[model samples]
Target: MNLNKAWGILKENGFKETTKRNQILEIFEGDERYLTARDILDVMQKDYPSMSYDTVYRNLATFVSLDILEATELSGEKHFRMHCESDHHHHHFICMDCGKIKEIPLCPMDLLGAALPAYEIDNHKFEIYGKCPECK
Candidate 1:
């Protein structure tokens, strides 16, 4: 999502805008890759030398809960990226090495649903993780 839309969501949710929050959003705005807390802290430290990990993590959690960011686990650590702007149903292919993401325009549930006719599924998330072409 764009900065304006992100700010609007924050306001709608009664969240106050802050310089740190704006900087966090800017970090994710133009990037398609996921970033870990450490990755973000490194950049944020440049501007806010006294920033703590707790503060960075708190904001990340807030963003995820607000749907402004999406989270995933890779190599046993959580990584985050801005929520996709697509209005259509889709999944993703994530690069294990570089944190890059590629949109997958297909859903596997179509076939998985057929295989499990006895069960009802309400929701699901699908992502394939591997090295992207450039990383490979």
Candidate 2:
């Protein structure tokens, strides 16, 4: 995504666009993979040498909060990916070795919700992990 699209997304969420935010978004612009804070920092620090760890973390939290990004905790570390909501809700099968993502056709919670009507469901996150074709 270009700077304009990034700005547009931020504006749609009522967030003011900034250099740092754009730089952060650029890291995932054309990539469809999970990235850790350190992974992002390594790429960002090349241009933004003064960027701090806290700044990357804060921006990540903001992106996740704004629904522009999704975070999944894997192996005790949080990994982030761009979020694009489709008409039908689904989950993902994430390749642990390559960070490749494959969309799951159905959500398990839908069936669970039907089975447990009394439970009030607020949110859900699902990710399956394994090796990708190339990795295998």
Candidate 3:
């Protein structure tokens, strides 16, 4: 993902580019899977010895508000995922047993989109729960 474009979006939303924010963005840029605040904190502490958990959490909220990132809640816990709409818009299927999240390409939208008016509907997200292959 382009960190520069994400940073520009943040700046346009009145967020300053602080060192903590930069570090958080760096982590997001490197992540290939969905990450939670706790996951980011653990990773950040290893790379940035002086970084605080609160700093990571705060920056996460800012990024979400700026629409540079997105948050998903599963079983009462939150997960953060990149919001690069240009990549692909899809939903997720999570394994409750193993805490694994799998991306599922959107198939139903094509059928529904033909029936609904654009302005009448805003956006959507779907999540399915079951044991993943390994867990099952």
Candidate 4:
């Protein structure tokens, strides 16, 4: 949610307290947009010259594994968003024509959770494809 909270989560996940990691959190905090490895690396490059793309990727993977972030595929690229512990879970909407991604509030599971009697569904993903408002 906030920088201090994010730092605590990373620390609990065994992430060392470093300037690079702090900067990464800052970037996410400042923008609500979901970011891919390239997006993050590009921003990091502005402030941190020694930061490598590989390192950014690795750190993002670790954050996802630790449940500190959510990874989604939008517009054919992977994106990461910080998972605020108290926030309600939701899905995404992607515009196929203009490459716009928006967070959709409804969780379809509320409607389908009872129908899944034959199989165990640990988790599910729902993405609706269409033109976004601006693209339309």
Q: Quote the lDDT for 74 in model 2.
A: 86
Instruction: State, as a TM-score between 0 and 1, how close model 1 is to the true structure.
Output: 0.90
Against the true structure, candidate 2 reaches a TM-score of: 0.87
1 or 3, greater by lDDT = 1
- For candidate 1, what is the total of clashing residue pairs? 0
Q: lDDT tens digits, residues 1-136, model 4? A: 7778878888876778988888887887776657889989999998887789888988888778877677888767898877644577877776667545687888888988679798989878898888889889
lDDT (10s digit) by residue, model 2, range 76-112? 9999988855657888888988897888989888678
Best by lDDT: 1
Candidate lDDT scores, in order, read 0.91, 0.82, 0.76, 0.78
lDDT of 1 by residue, 1-136 (tens): 8889999999999999999999999999978899999999999999999989998999999999998998988778999999999988888999988889999998988777678777888878798989999999
Model 2 misplaced stretches (Cα beyond 4 Å): 1-5
**Superior by TM-score: candidate 2 or candidate 3:** 2
lDDT (10s digit) by residue, model 3, range 1-136: 4589888888887888777678778877776456878888888788778778788778888788877887888667788877756567677787777656677877567778668666666667778889889899
Model 3 C-alpha RMSD vs. true structure (Å) is 3.9
Where does candidate 1 have its weakest 10-residue lDDT segment? 109-118
Candidate 4's C-alpha runs over 4 A off are: 84-86, 94-103, 129-136
Candidate 3 Cα deviation (angstroms), residue 80: 0.4
Higher-scoring candidate on TM-score, 1 or 3: 1
lDDT of 3 at 38: 84
Q: Candidate 3 — worst ten consecutive residues by lDDT sum?
A: 116-125
